[model samples]
Target: MPLPKAQTLFGYSPEAPELSKAEVSRRFDELMATIDSLPTRHVGASEVAQAFGEGRGIDFGARPGNAFEALTKALDGPDIAKAMSSDALASVTSALEALKAEQPDLMKDITPSSPIGTGLVAYDLEAPAKMLTPRPTPLRNRLPRKKGIGLSHQFKVISGFTGTATGGVANIHPGIGDTTQTNFAPSGASNALYYARGPKISYAGYDKTVAYSQFSVSDAVTWSAQYAGQGYQDVRQLSRTSLLYSSMLLEERMLLMGRGTSGRGFLGAVAAPTGVALTARTAAGSEVALSGFTTNVYVKVTSDAGDFGQSVLSTAANVGVTAGQVVDVTCVLPAGATGVRVYVSTGASDPGDASRWYAGRVGYNTFTLQGALPTSGVAASTITADTTAYTNGYDGILPICTGPDSGYVNRLNAVLSNTNPGSEWQTAFAALYDAVKADPDRTLLNGSDRKQLSDALKTNSSSNYRMTITQDQLTGVTLGDVVNTIINEVTGKGVAVEVHPWMPQGNAPIISDTLPLPDSEVSDVWSVFNVQDLLGVDWPVTQFAFESSSYWMGALLCYAPAWNGAITGIKKA
Candidate 1:
């Protein structure tokens, strides 16, 4: 059948032109040919213009089709810009302005004059500078603190034996009479026959003077500076805090080595001069070639009443000897001397030479220098001078522990050889714990002393001190952390090794116990008797500027001197 024209399909005309079957076939063929002649894929702008009319598609031969591109070309060409319509040019200009407002030119050079280039343009600065000064108060923090109602704190200590049981056991025949009754009789007919005299109890009283430290600051700073622009905001508050720290330092020194010569500071732990006195040598023995001696050396003796309590060195006696010859000296035994320590000078003629090398221990008054020369020993200068009548200050820990009263025995040599740096410390600590019969909690020494111990441990190959590495754990490697504690071989308990910067060199104090005194409580070993804690007040001002002051009043009281002791005369590692 033949198809009608497009006007007939729309019902525009019922009698629309209809062709025969051959004419209709020819028209369909011609339509298909026209569709094939058109582009099957994308064509360029010129091809599109040629395919469609120039006015309908794009004027590619004359100008760009995009309004942006056409505007850019017109800007460079005055003739093209004149030909462009005002509305089209206005639209492109509006778009460019909008873009300029939204996006800044970040690629532009930044100069010193540019406000955006400066870092402080909108920066927020911190108010005050941080304070990094180191202020450590180890002893003050550990000791107990208590309040006192009076100006002085006093306490009583038992000094002698008590009870009436001085008689010893005795054997007697069953028939005749008991010998115990006769042996237990009173002396000088002062009491009834066969009745033993009672033992009188003795006590020693001790008093501590309250000490104080104060600081003052000018009030003018408070008014002159309101903010922290100069690093500190409140000068008065800073001064108060600083005073508290400095006062603690003063108190700590008094607790350790104070010699209250001025009657202001309290007595310290190593300030007592209570060693047995040796005025002069009774016999300066003959010089012999027993050991190699390069120069003349001084000799001194220390008496011990059998207890670990060692006395201070006696007066140094100069014994002139040449190289390859050693001096042999003898002295009358001082009363109450159960044992004696012999010391020699390190080739110095000065009788008061600070360095005193340990020669040996002797039971008799006679001492013979033997073996090679000693390379390490205690320094006499480090030991504190004995105070007269103990009125200068209270006897510190060293004198109390090594004095005749406490019975502390120090039998080991005072020197530590570099070849075996850790041996003396380890042995001394172990012996100290055993003598005290308690596990020591801490061992306080100088940093140099601790370093020596640590270095010795690092080089030691003993399994007890070193760690084992296996094949299965070979990926990650570490050389082990520095050890800060040592386990007692006897008690199997670890004692913390603390390095105290303020600790006197050559003195290592072993503290067996410590208690936390939160508020007016007491410690087992020591306490701080406080007449008044840290207090501050603004002083009466006569001028326009005012002043403030802070103060602390307290004294350190050692309860049990026997429970704590020190390893003195430590020269180095």
Candidate 2:
């Protein structure tokens, strides 16, 4: 026996299948006549069948017996030509007529019997301006604090002077009635006078000149002593130094009396001197009392000397002290002492109180001694040197994934390896797998479809398909390239395309007995066949079966198209 034709075997026999020839012929004639007489009519199945009968192979199916059936059959064709035929066109025309009859206003343009023209009119209309609501009040009205100069001073010394001198003099007694007078004066009177002439100088000198070239003695040399006493008073007013003390009392207590609630015992106090003394003493007379004292206290002292050891005197006790008690302490100013300070603490044994004591009063002074005064005419250049080591430690290895590239897998890996792995990317990958497994349209397929799908994906230029490949199948492809390919394919085919990245599968597992798939074999088959088949002509074969079962056997299938016919075949395998 002759082998059956491929067409017959495939259910498309050479002999037309048993169909109503007279009904099909009548339907074709009526549809063709209607299409020839009407505008805006679409080809129907009858037109497609008539075209087939006119020595043209039917790209679609056999003719239907009526306009509706014929149009439906034509529209279901793989190619557009069979659907755009005379009978199909006539069916569309009859549809238009029926629609016109049903809606008189819509038919008015085509109904020549009516006097109306196109039935649509253009008119200008104005839209009222929209009213705007009042703006809301601001949450805050306070302005930022302005920067101000603290304390500053400047001084200039125009001039200064010092002097030293040495000299010898002799005096002679005058006779009681002698008329001659001897005057004594310095030898360099003009020189001494000139030296004292300046803007800030004044001088006075006793004048006397004595010369002894010869000596004479009386018959009886007698020495007479003359004494004169002049009394002058040196007066000075004694100025007493005053000390000012300030203290802060910080007391904390917790009661655990009821319901066995735990309690915390704390006692802390602080005391500070307005200014430090040059010397401190433990003797009774020199000590001063601070105003505020809690169970425990801390004191800080400040002085112009900026010397902690010399200025600050502190006493502390670990045992809790009375809320208010005058602990004897002494501060003394020894002879020739310039400044002094005292710091006292009464608190827990912990050294935290000592730090606070230093900070509250003595910190500024200690800082000054270390040459850390902000006003020491120093620049901020030193801070840069200290921070250089920290800045240099930050190499490019700490990559920052920003902008569109942030979601890329490589960027995600960079973050995982170098930064934080428990980030959004990991969560996203999990979410994506979950979504794929949850999809209802996914199915199991043979290996051939997987290859075809993979190849299609590799060559397809449609961004929509590209997105499907990456997002739905988890293709691990570059997002930019995927997007570009999808765009090219969609534009080449003259079809509108929309590309959306696949959402992560979240915490859901890729495959589980509780999931929609039955077993690993089913999942494998679905990954190889169903996923690629769903990708259609826009995806690649390699994309479907790019790796062994190790890579995708247990992986969830995703990214089936909503518009695709393959969605109907998906089932639990």
Candidate 3:
């Protein structure tokens, strides 16, 4: 079999020549007929598959050495191989056709007929970003936050003891033995001895009470379950819980407001001015109490008609009546069923015009009258009930300090008015430190900002009086800001200061509630934890409900009363 001869020029019959087109084509045909048989097209996928064998192991030592070696070496290097092997290349190549036939969908969108390129041009062409999410919360990067808190643990416990109990009431003794603190000695050998009993311990008992607060999230259970594995929850849910804590702080601050509704006491009233009372005339033997007299006010009495007036009963001083000021009045009414009248007056008694006088409302200290006064009938046109006695807000530290009695025995020197109230802190504190010094235990002076307080103690700049500021106090405070100072009286020579938020800004309180002091009756805010599980769940009972934590507390200012004294009512400059 000979190959077809190549035609030249006009396709005419040509003479044989060594380099002629017909002779060359004829020779090429003779050479091809003598060559071994070969396939017409390039190697197919099946042919490559055959070369790869069962293992598809590429080997340089196989038939077709250089071509196999080049393709196989590219297999060892990924970048080179990525460009070399593919579905389209496999169809046109022969030596390494087997390798390309086993090609993965590495070029995800590439195909046998597809044009290849580089970069994003050849990458996924639909969009540059991934599919958008519905409500994706970005990861939060911030400092960890701590929320609502209240008073210290000491306020919730008995002053001298520790540990939890259903109710821990500690009885503090005053150590004043021998029936009385005083002893009697006769001049002769016959001093009478009165020896009686063994249980001479005079104990003041202080008890504990509890407080609570609670809150619930809207879809808390559902949301928590949804975001169970997440590090943070929805912003709304976090706020709802934090609000519960805020409520706790609010209640706690009020409890610390010195006094409140009922006996929901904080610290005992230590700053009340004593002898600030509405008293009856001592000389007249005609004493009376007023209905609306909540605070000390002045009054004048007179005998307009001398109806039953034996003596003038008044608060005015008897003898030296200054031109404008009336310290006391001298008046009295006989004991009989007769009407009497009292009038509000800072001036001398006006005898002529009854219309000019305001009748004083009467109560408790009842006295008899011999005859009716001219202006005694009507409830109006005269004095009404006094308003100075009552108030809704807690009795601030001032009133608490002013009014102390037996059991809560703080030595009170009641005065009608502290004229020089500015220097009252020095006088009051000197008394307090002196009384507690004998106990051999330290004391704390707890209070908020008050007038002249800092100025009064500025001289004792040493350890005698220094401030222990809290983290909360550090905020919003500068050099001149009125601040509560916590002073530690460690050596029995100084006093401790605790600036509490709930303490009234006007009337300062001194206590050991925060920093610590010797056993003073007013130190503990007794909280009895009947059931203190603050965060408990109640499903159907409350609508997606969460309860605020709560507890019961009562101020226990009854232990070792003599150990505490407050110098209240100093004004600020």
Candidate 4:
């Protein structure tokens, strides 16, 4: 059959000569008649039924060239010579006509389409800015973190030797024979003499203890919230960061204040008062009127010197008076005591109950009980009966240095209200360094205490001094907003002062990184022991939302407590 002319196929052509509409219609009809007169080609069932072989014998190259060619071959067979046969052409044309009927619904026309209008708000079209999370946890980040073994971390502390020395040397002699007499002494002797004993090697057995603590944090995110935050933020990651940080802040607090709910928290670095007591005197004067003194009640007071701790019960004062009678008990406050808690016995002489205690500061130390006596019970329990003692948490530096039996640190009483307050503070600081005979890594104090120290320095100085801060091409000058250091006269070294936000005001602790032990495996004297370090996990979503949690199981360990020292009872000038 002859091919249709270009002008007849396209109905019109730019380069072709103009032709009558009747001539073009006649050419198109002749092309259609020739195509329809072609012989029909049929695919046999045997050929279409052939299946692809498996294994190495399978020929992947036997696949049809493309989807269109494959469909055409399946319906008309692979004979290129008869590809345009009437039956084969009709089968392909029928399939194509069906596809064309659905083309308008499935395909989009881009020619007539325009960009979206500008009437929408800018906020809706633009992406959001990045979010910010600021975490201010200094002690937790600064203290060294380490991994521990078993349920608890154990270590041995060697205090001193218990061996005794033999002053004078002894003489020894062997049995004398006929010809020669044996003598082991500076002077020769005939009689047999002997020193009775072996060498004595004795030393103190090391004290060993275990440290352990654990805490956890959890959070949840709804499906809708997470899905809504898809492009704006990663809600899951943000939740994880927040949870982990929250856990760390708790750990930091525990490091400072160890007495958590049931004493299951980390042991703090500061020590609880062990043996300090206040002196008591009882008389009937006018400090405050007594209220519940129907019977004779025994009064005892305990002192809390800054972060040192609430001291043990003091000497009981027996006051005999009726209800509403004035009970004035003059008490002698300890050298460094800042606050006091007064406990009264329900009976004549039993102050063991923990329910009848009244809390008071130093100014409120006067006992003014003015209520009718309802119930009479024993005295309140001490810090030891409950689990408030330093058991779960390790004994921190402050405890090790200032503990009753520690004999390592020099405890100096500072009076900030003295006439020469600056000189007094300087003397106390110098005394502490002098006792230790070395400088500390850094001096930790509350922000209020730091201000007091700075004020003291300014008051002590001869004049308001200022240095000329000249800046040139190669020179630069830097100034501090506040005084951050003090000079230790003993060591002639500048003590670096750091403000601890959580530290209890009115006291400053000088901590040394170097342990007193000659051979220490730990690099830092103070370190956090982790049986299980920080771990985070996501729970399987039961509903449309998911929950995540994080855990940190550890305790603070102090290798050498004596190397660290603190100045207690610091009153801000």
Winning model by lDDT? 4
Per-model TM-score on C-alpha atoms: 0.47, 0.14, 0.30, 0.48
Top model number, TM-score: 4
Alpha-carbon local distance difference test for all models: 0.50, 0.24, 0.32, 0.53
Global local distance difference test of model 4: 0.53
Q: Write the per-residue lDDT of candidate 1 for residues 506-565, one digit (tens) a residue.
A: 556666665222331334666766667766667776655446665666555665555555
What TM-score does structure 4 among the candidates reach? 0.48
Q: Positional deviation of 258 in candidate 4, in angstroms?
A: 2.1
Q: What are the per-residue Cα lDDT tens digits for candidate 2 across 480-546? A: 3211111112112211111111101011111111223344223221111111111101122343221
Q: What is the lDDT of candidate 2?
A: 0.24
Model 1: residue 49 alpha-carbon error in angstroms: 33
Q: Which of the two, 1 or 3, has more TM-score? A: 1
Q: Candidate 1: what lDDT?
A: 0.50
Off by over 4 Å in 1: 1-126, 159-177, 182-189, 196-232, 262-422, 429-439, 461-464, 469-476, 490-492, 514-523, 544-546
Tens-digit per-residue lDDT, 206-322, candidate 3:
553222222223223444443552444443344444444543444344333323323333322111111112334323334232233212334344222111111133333212222
Per-candidate clash tally: 10, 60, 56, 10
Q: In what order do the candidates fall by lDDT, top score first?
A: 4, 1, 3, 2
